[model samples]
Target chain A: MNIYIGAENIISPLGSTAEENFGALSKNSSGIKKTEAAGFDKKSIFFSRFAENTNDFSFDALLKNCLKNVRSKISPDIFSSEKTLLILSTTKGDIKSENVNPIGKSVSELQNSFELKHAPIVVSNACASGVIAINTAANFIRAGVYETIIVAGCDVISDFVTYGFECLFAISDKPCAPFDKNRTGITLGEGCAAVVLSSHKTIFNVEPMRFIEGTSGNDANHISGPSRTGEGLYRTVKKTLELAGITEKDIDFISAHGTATVFNDDMESVAFDRLNMQHIPLNSLKGYYGHTLGAAGIIETAICLQSMRNNTLIKSMGFEEEGTVKKINIISENKKLSLETVLKTSSGFGGVNASLLLKKS
Target chain B: MNHLSSYCHISTKEIVTDKGALLFDNTEGLEVNDFLKTVYKKLAIDYPKFYKMDSLSKAAFLGVELLKKENAALAEYADDEIALLFANSNASEDTDKKFVNSYAEEHAPSPSLFVYTLPSILMGELAIRNKWYGESLFVILQKFDAAFFADYCNMILLRNAKACICGWIEITEGKTEAFIFLAEKNGNENNTPLTKQTIEKIYKTIMKQSRPSKV
Candidate 1:
């Protein structure tokens, strides 16, 4: 069964809609900037936070707004249908809550607010949450469990998360420079992005892309660090391509998971090199999005869809020179590309890697 | 033709298998960490990384160790065929609280504790220990829904994974309990058909034995 994905929306510091975010990328603009006293030590730190995020703006509000936007893009009755499920991808949803149940309350509120018949499944698998959630949806659709599933990913910057990263020194002082020679570390970001996938294409109001296949693999390595050999990423991408019955040549562009952490970018480069995909034009949206944790996969995948729609390739922002030990083609400038198939990849804290394939259909 | 090949459960009070055999019992009212440590010693497994894991991860790790001990076939499966699917209601809450207090009170953020803040890091520990490179997911549900695990196992058994390990772990203070099982595509003579009804039956039966130790 060929699953279809459309009715996508993104609410990020770059912009609210897919068009605005893509436009900013086309202009080579980034959302990351220094925020005053944002660090645990009361020092300034670079973050890609929403300028419109007033003190009143909350995580629930971001999800509600994004869901509303995507709801309008697809059939109005889908949310109430028993065969439709909402899959939420978030690393830390309201982590500041005293209860420490980051997603339980939010899931309940969403179920009540949206009047969803099926209880939403929450995927909190660190940075890979978004990609895993979408893959879960795709699996359900293929297995005839759910005809349509809405995958929403969101993660807001919190002091708990910031302090943790700060202690690890994983946050960059300046904007993140993914796949760049001088790339430092991640710049925290916050956003909510949602995409709808269905077995029936008629449910989508816009032209849907073919959801080819997606899969995940564990690195069986360190918990906090990416594999030195990029074992998990290589395995997942290989499995995805094998399942889709396509070779590396079938993928036009690659949406790489360039988190800007020294080990991360190098690991990704190693994976691509091992797969013999080093020559593929690839870009990392982290320079613009700042590694938005759970939202990174969905936000970046939405950008991939838009790249297909506009026939434009967004450059790897903040990248200047070759960095990794292995050689690869990194998009250095925004240009037109006759894109047909693209692959999105994500690697996170749990020594896990995930990849998804999408094609213009 | 999916089968519940083998299962193991660990709590603060006891460690047992699905065949109603008590592998170990705790009467000293040891805390969760100590109880799991004793169980580990009883199993005579030597992996120093065990101490670095949080209570949740330790529980899942111990459960997997027990599962592998009972069913040698699982240890022999291809590394990518044993998909690890785990879930928890609290989701590393105990470690999250510890990390939060480390900064909020001591004004010192501990990176080691912070790394275990994600619930799925337990799966990482398992993957590293067992060298199982299969697909993994750590979902957060309000409660342990047996039917959900059964359906997910069935969904994967037919497609990618040859065996699925649906692990459920929760460390609520001293009341730490973890249940892990290997669901195989082919059944053994002692195996039960993988179904929602069988899973619920096994869940209730195993959960009833996982009593809390008075810390």
Candidate 2:
């Protein structure tokens, strides 16, 4: 049984739709900018936030808007169908809310607004939430628990999160330069992205890509720090390839989770090198998206779908010179290529690493 | 069909096993952290990292520790054979509030508290302790749903993992109710079949007997 994935939607600083974001990416546009006095110490910090006002409830707005856009792209009957289940991937949903249960209200709001057949399951595994949510959706479809699953990943920029990162000194001072020699750290961003996975491809108005296989692994090393050996990332990619019945050589491109923190990009380089995928052209979308946290894996996967559709290799936005101990073929220029199969990987806090494969179908 | 090999429940007042055997009762009226320390001492766990973890991680660690104590064969599995699938209602809300207070009231964001803001950190703690590099995921549900756990655990066990350590660790508003269970391919005659009804029954039975502990 093959899971078909399509109807990709993105609500980010770059644009509201996947096509628009892809267009901006093709032009090497970055959403990151220096915000005045956004840091805990009142220091100017770089952030990739929505240009339009989100009216204080950015989390809710992003979800509602992204879902509405996703609803438009798929068959109308799918939303009302009992076989469809909704999964929300978020690190923090409305953290600014006074209520202790920050995500419950948003889940209810989304279900009520969309008239979803079932209550959405929320995945909140730090930064890996998005990819794991999509993987969970595919797992459900394969298990015959649901025919169609809509996975939405969203996180908003707030003082709560920003200050937390700032305290940890994980926020980059400049627009994040992932995998670059001068890379500092992550530039936090806000965005929401959703994709529809189904057992049948006919539900999508556009041609859907084959949801090959997705898997996650833990580093078992640190809660906050990535492993020096990239054990989890390496294992997940290997597991994904094995489950997909493919080889490292078959992966044409890699969408790596390069958070631009000196350690993360280095860790990914080691992982890819260990997987013998060092030669495969890879790009970290963080240079453009600025590590959008929970929304990253979905948005980047959505971009990969668009790349497969357009047959274009989007450049690693801020990468210039090689940085890591293990060399990786980072795409420095946007080029057209025959991308048959692409691997998307993400590593997050809590020692979580996830990888998924998507083949052009 | 998968098997619910071993399970442990940690509530505010006491700890219980799958057979309704009381492991430890909190007669000291200790706080959340103190209660976890008491359990850790009772189990004779030497991992000093337990002292550094937040309430959610402590609860989950204790729950898993108790489960492993009951199922000695679990330690024989390969490092990457066991997966961690945990869910909760509030999602690190207990720590989130403390972290928020650090910046809002204390005038400085506490990095230590901030790191524990995600509930998945507990899984990381488990992975580090057990050196299990298998799959790990943390989901937020409005309430505990046994069907979701059974179906998801079955899917994960079929495709990615050989055994799964699943839990519903909810620590919010000074209340801790962590129910951690292990699901494996084979079951002994005494083990229960992994099903929604059995899981719900076990959870309810544990919750009904728990007396809320004072912080």
Candidate 3:
């Protein structure tokens, strides 16, 4: 069973659609800027936030907005079909409003408003939530449980999360510079994005790409810290490639989980080095879209699809010098390339890492 | 040939297995912490990390440890061949509230509490204890859906894993319900297909046997 993935949509600070987001990326325009007294300590911090004037600021609103946009690109009947499933990925869903049960009401609203035949599966596996949600969708399709799945990832910024990171000293004071020497920490952002995966490629309005396969691995090291050996990320990529019957040589680019935290970037660099994939073109969009937590994976993967469609590679914005102990090629400028196969990977707080491969169909 | 091998359940006051035997119980109306500690001590698994775990992780750790005790073969499998699938209705709400109170009431946020805010961190704790590198996923459904677990475990078994430990560990307010079952690609002593009905039957039996009146 071949999984076809496309119909990518996003509602981020940069733009409202994947094409629009890619347009901003092509011109090297970033969404990150300093917010006044945003930190827990009343320190101004860099964040990618929507204008106060926008209507899609809340968690539920952004999810609805992105889902409606995605619905426009696919067949209308899929949403109500029993064979189609919706998988929501988020670290914290509406936590600021309903801390007692953050995700339940939002998920219920999505099901009722969208008229989905079945309840959606809500994934809250920290940052890897988005990546794992996509993988879970593919598994469902492959097992014939569902013919189609809409993998939606959404998260909104809140004082609760901000203070948590602030207490841990993880929030960057300036714009995050992924894989850069001076990189401090992540600048949290908020957004909603989704992609469609189906056994029937015709459901997609645009030509869908082949979703080869994906897998996850655990570092088994620490809950809040990344593994120095990148054990989980490396093993996941290895398993994914082996399952897809490919190698590092077949990959044209990598959309890495460069959180800009010293440990995370270096850990990824170490993993890429260990995999002997140092020569592949790689970039982290966190610089443009800040670290959107659960939405980061889906948003970045959508941009990867755009990169494939346009035959262009987006730069690792905010990256100037080689920083990691291991040497991996980080794109510093936008360039054109015939991208045939690409890989996207994400590692999060729970000692979890995930990877997936996309090939031109 | 995928089948349910072993299962363990922990209600607010009782700890029982699928073998028609109660391993332990708290008839004294002890607090959640004290009850879990009594079970941990009975097992005599002296891993100090238990003290640091949130109530959710502590309960799950106890569940898995008892599972290993019942099915010794669980440890025989290769590390990467065993996967962990856990979920809950409330996520880490108990810890979330605590973390919030740390900043809102205590005037300072604690990093330790913030680290355990995500429910999947409990899965991480399990992975570290066992050193398993297999695929792990934690999902949130509105309630305990045995059908979903069966579907997910079947999907996971399609991968390289030979066995999977699926759990629904929910800890909220003063309520606690932890149930974990092992699904093997092949049956060991007995054969019970890993279907929705089988999982539901087993969990229901445990629920009925543990608290009796509460469930």
Candidate 4:
């Protein structure tokens, strides 16, 4: 069974639609900006936030907006079809809510508003939630469990999450510079993005790319820190390539996680080098969107699809110099290339790492 | 179809096996930590890292330990063959509240508690303890849905994993309920096939027995 992914939608600080976000990226524009007195201690912190001046940037609103945007790009019947399933990926969904389960209300609301046939499943695997959710969609579609799956990843910026990262000193003082020597840590961001995966390609109003294969692996090492050897990442990428029946040589571009955290970037570099993909052109979208936590993977994959459609490789924003010990080719400037296949990888807390292959249809 | 090899249930009061046999009961008026510590001591597993995990992780760890004890065949499988699929209605709520209090009520935020705010951290703990680098997924559903679990387990087994350790572990408001089950491709003739009815039956039995009618 061929899983076709299309009708991508990204509602981020950059733009509302996928193409608009990609256009901003092509122009070297970043959504990250320093917000005065945003930190826990009233310190100025850098974060990519939706430009909407109102505090109405709630999780439920973002999810609805992203889904509405996605609905415009795909067949309307799929939303209410029994054979279609919805999967939501988020880390801390509406953390500020008084209810203990922050995601339940939003899931119910989305189901009711969209008239979904089935209750949505919410994946909350830290940052890997988005990638893993997409992979789960592919798995379900291949198994004939659902003919179509709508995977939406969303996370809103809240004091609970921001302060938590601030306490860990993981928040970068400036816009995140992934794969760069001066990169300090992640600049947290917020956004909602979604992609549709279906066995029937004709369902998409536009040409849908093939979702070749996706898999996840655990480092089995540390919960908070990445593996020094990139054990989990290497294994996941290796398994993904093996499942896809393709070699590293077949991957034209790599959308690396590159969270800009020193340890994370180093771990990714080691994994790529171990896979003998040191020279493959790779870029991290974190520099543009900041680390959007759960939304990072979906938004990045949507950008990857946009890049394939445009035949342009967007540069790794804020990446100016080599930082990792194992040298991997980092895209410093936007370049036009004949990109046929792209590998998207993400590594997050909990020793979790996920990788998936997307090919031009 | 996969086989439901073994399962274990952990509630606030007792730890029971899949067969509805009580393994351990909390008679010491112990809280979550003390209850977990008592179970850990009874099991005689000496892993210092267990003390550092949140309540959610501890419940999952204890449940897996009990499952492994019941089904020794699980130990025979190679690492990276067992996928961990877990879901809960209240995802890390206990830890999330603690983290929130750490910063809002308390003067400083605790990094240790903040790290466990995500429910998947429990999966990491299990992976680190067992050294299994297989696929892991942590989902938050409205309630325990047996059909979803059955369908997802079948899909996972078909894809990459040889077996799956699936659970619906919910810990919140000083109450805990964890039902962890092991699903394998083939099992002994006596083993039941992993189906929606079987999972729902087990969950209902445990929930009913653990929480008797108030009347």
Candidate 5:
């Protein structure tokens, strides 16, 4: 069963929609900027972002736009009430009520906003939520549960998460430099991406990107931090390859979850070293998209799929001098290649980790 | 061929299962931490940080332990030998609210509390408790889908996972509800074929039955 990721819709710092965002990627632009939210003003944190709020882009509007984009690309009749599942990955999932309206504390009030009558599954797995959302949809496809599953991951930089990261002392007050020697902390950003996966071999006279295989694991080594040895990540990467019947050499490009945090970059470097994939052209989209939290996996995965279709890999924007971690060939500039398969890897708090293999059809 | 034979449900003030007897049932809705402390007292388990663990951690802690007691063979598997999947309707929104409130007040957010905000942490805690770690996944759904539940079990078995814990847990407004089942693959060379009809029938029956703990 070929799970196709067709018509990825994204809204990030660069711009909204795949065309706008990918245009920025191709031009080597940086989306990290000083945030102007009232929440940030109260806090002393300087460097952060809220996705450029284009006119009339509310949460509902974003969903409607994403659905519209996908609708234009795929046939509506395909999803005619056959239990087409909608699995969402998000952290700041309409959580304004809990912050504004003081109730006894329930997340359900926030979840109530995600009631898509056609698509009704939501996943809030912290940073790895997006990958898990994709995994959830793909598993349903493999299990023959639903014919079509729409995996959408989106999160806005809310006062809830923004100040929460600030309180943890993990937010960078300056532009984030992922994998850099002097990297201080992570910069937050917002984006939403929706991917439609189906058991159909092809769709709409287009060959959708194929989801070959993927794996997820937990280090159980820490509650908030990742393993220094990258044991969980290494195991997940190896298992992903094994399940896909591919090898380290088979992966053409590596889309790393480089959040510009000190620990995550270091840990991922060790994981890549163990996998003997150091020379692979690797880059993190965090510099461009900021850390979209739960949406990072889907947002980055969408970009990689777009790049695969165009046969080009976007450069890592903020990477310059190598950090204290092991060295890899970071794509500092856009490059063209016969990229067949790309590996998208992400690790999050609670020692949760995941890697997905995407192949160009 | 994995099937949910029996299951259990635990909340802030109740422990309901198909044991034909009530373990503990109370109407007073204890706070999240205090409820977990009660779980410790009743189960006679010793861990200094019982109250400090996250909701998923506490729930998975209780679910896996009770599951082990029912099926002791679960202990023999390797770290990644068995599969664990969790579905939450609303994950850690309360925690996120608390963290934000604390941050708004300039208080240092506890990493311990930050840890539970992720829905998958519960499954991780279960893996750490028992060495079984074959394939683990955590999902947040608006609600449980019987078809998706059965589909998940089939994939776990197809991926060669020996046993799977497939269920849902939700904690909101001082109320926590969790349902966990220990499902092992059918020994048959061919998996037990479960179609939508059989799953819906099971769901209808289970939905209508009264709480065994209350009985």
Candidate 6:
């Protein structure tokens, strides 16, 4: 089934909404900037950030805002209590409260901010949650349970995320480089993205930007680290391609997860090479959008969908030199191409890997 | 066939099926942790490592033991044929809180405390223990959904997994509570059509009977 994702809103170091985010992507402007957080003793940390103006935003309010913006653009009557299922994904939902306790509370003790507002289904599978959420929603829609399903994902950077990454020495103090050999560590960012999928692709007059054919897999390796062989990612991409009923040759552009970290980039390269897709044009949005964590998957999906709609492609920011894994062609400059399909993949802390195939409609 | 091979719940030592009971009530309190010590002791696991494990891992530890005790007919098959699926609320908020709290006080976090942050780690630990290298997933939905469970099980079966170990495991405070069932491929040609109602019916009944009545 072809799933349509329309009208996305993002709060990243790039920009808050699609307009700002797109503008930043076109200009090759990065949202990563130096900030003095409370806990870190370091003078500065480079973060691809979304403004933390969430004081006025409740879980319900955020959902409503996303709904409101999307609703205004699309037909509101299409989703009026029409048995729409919501599958929301996030790495840190209301982690600000957890930062107060060092030992952590039990599952029942944790406050579920998203549950308090909307009755949508939630996912927190580390970084892989975003793509899984979309894939799950797509499956639900494809199964004919709900006529339409709402896929929303978000995560905010806080002391917990910062300190957690810092403990692992994964945070880079400067803007990230997607596939660059000199890349150091990832820069954390915050953002939210919402996509609506319907069973009938012709619901809205707008042509379907992309068709979601994605899959999720677990590596069963180290918990915090990605699999050294990229087995998880390799399998995920393979599964995604299998489900899409297409091989690697059908994909035009690759929206790489490209956290610009050492192990991650190398692992992605191995997976791409195994698929015999090293010649594909690829770049990481993290260099432009700042690793949005949970939101990165859906946000990048939206960006690719939009690029497909506009018939334009963007380049990887801060990508100076190619890394050791020299299989794929990294997009160095913005280029226009006949893009029919794009492959976007994300690997998270847990041995979780997810990949999605989106086609230009 | 797609029948109950063998399933167990270590907490309270009471294993109930649609047919009858295996053990009597042993402990009190709505908490899940009260009886986890027995699980640790029975498994002969180290206290410090056991204490440091997350609720899902502990629940998984107990679940795997139950699967082994029953040693269903399907256990003789390939280990990769068995799938593990978990569902829970609260997700990893507790671990996140602990992780954040570590840095919250001083901003410096110990790597040891940082390990259990992901909810799926429990699944990984359980895999390492059982060597069950089949399909696995950790889903966090609002409350619980039977359709989701049924759908996931069907997907596993579609992937041609020989058997499945699936359930809901939730723990808060020190309390751990779980209800898991082993499902095998059934019928001639090894096919069984299971619905959301089938899984939910057994889940609700086992879960209700496992807990002491309020009265």
For all candidates in order, the CA lDDT equals 0.89, 0.89, 0.90, 0.91, 0.71, 0.68
Estimate, for each residue in A1-361, the C-alpha lDDT of model 1 and write its tens digit: 8899988899998888888888899999999898999888899999998875484346898899999999999988998898999999998887892556657888999999999987788897889888989999999888888999999999988899999999999998889999999998999999999999999999898999989999999999999999999999999999999999999998899999899999999999999999999999999999998989999999988998999999999999999999887989999999998999999999999899999999999
Relative to the real complex, the DockQ score for model 2 comes to: 0.83
Q: What is the interface RMSD of candidate 5, in Å?
A: 3.4
DockQ-derived CAPRI band for the predicted complex in model 1: high
Quality of model 2 by C-alpha lDDT: 0.89
TM-score of each candidate's B chain against the true B chain: 0.95, 0.95, 0.95, 0.95, 0.82, 0.78
Candidate 4 Cα deviation (angstroms), residue A259: 0.6
For B122-209, candidate 3 gives per-residue lDDT tens digits of 9999999889888999999999999999998998897758999999999887798999989999666566899999998887777666
lDDT of 3 by residue, A105-212 (tens): 889999999999999999888899889999999999999999999999998888888898989899887899999999999989989899999999899999988899
Cα error of candidate 6 at position A175, Å? 1.4
Model 2, residue A139: C-alpha shift (Å): 0.5
In model 1, the runs with Cα more than 4 Å from the true position are A52-56, A97-99, B211-215
The residue-by-residue lDDT of candidate 6 on B169-202, one tens digit each, is 6665544556776766652343234667767676
| Model 2 stretches astray by more than 4 angstroms | A52-57, A97-100, B211-215
Please give, for residues A237-346, the per-residue lDDT of candidate 4 as tens digits.
99999998999999899999999999999999999999999999999999889888998899999999999999999999989988797999999899999999999999
The TM-score of chain B in candidate 3 is: 0.95
Q: What docking grade applies to model 3?
A: high
TM per model? Answer: 0.98, 0.98, 0.98, 0.98, 0.89, 0.86
Question: Chain A vs. true chain A, TM-score per candidate?
Answer: 0.98, 0.98, 0.98, 0.98, 0.91, 0.89
Prediction 4 global C-alpha lDDT: 0.91
Q: lDDT (0-100) at residue A231 of candidate 4?
A: 95
lDDT of 5 by residue, B96-174 (tens): 6566555556565555565566667766666555544356666655566666677777776777476778767777765
For model 5, fnat equals: 0.43
User: For candidate 2, lDDT tens digit of each residue in A12-74?
Assistant: 888989999999999999998888887878899888887655463388888898888899998
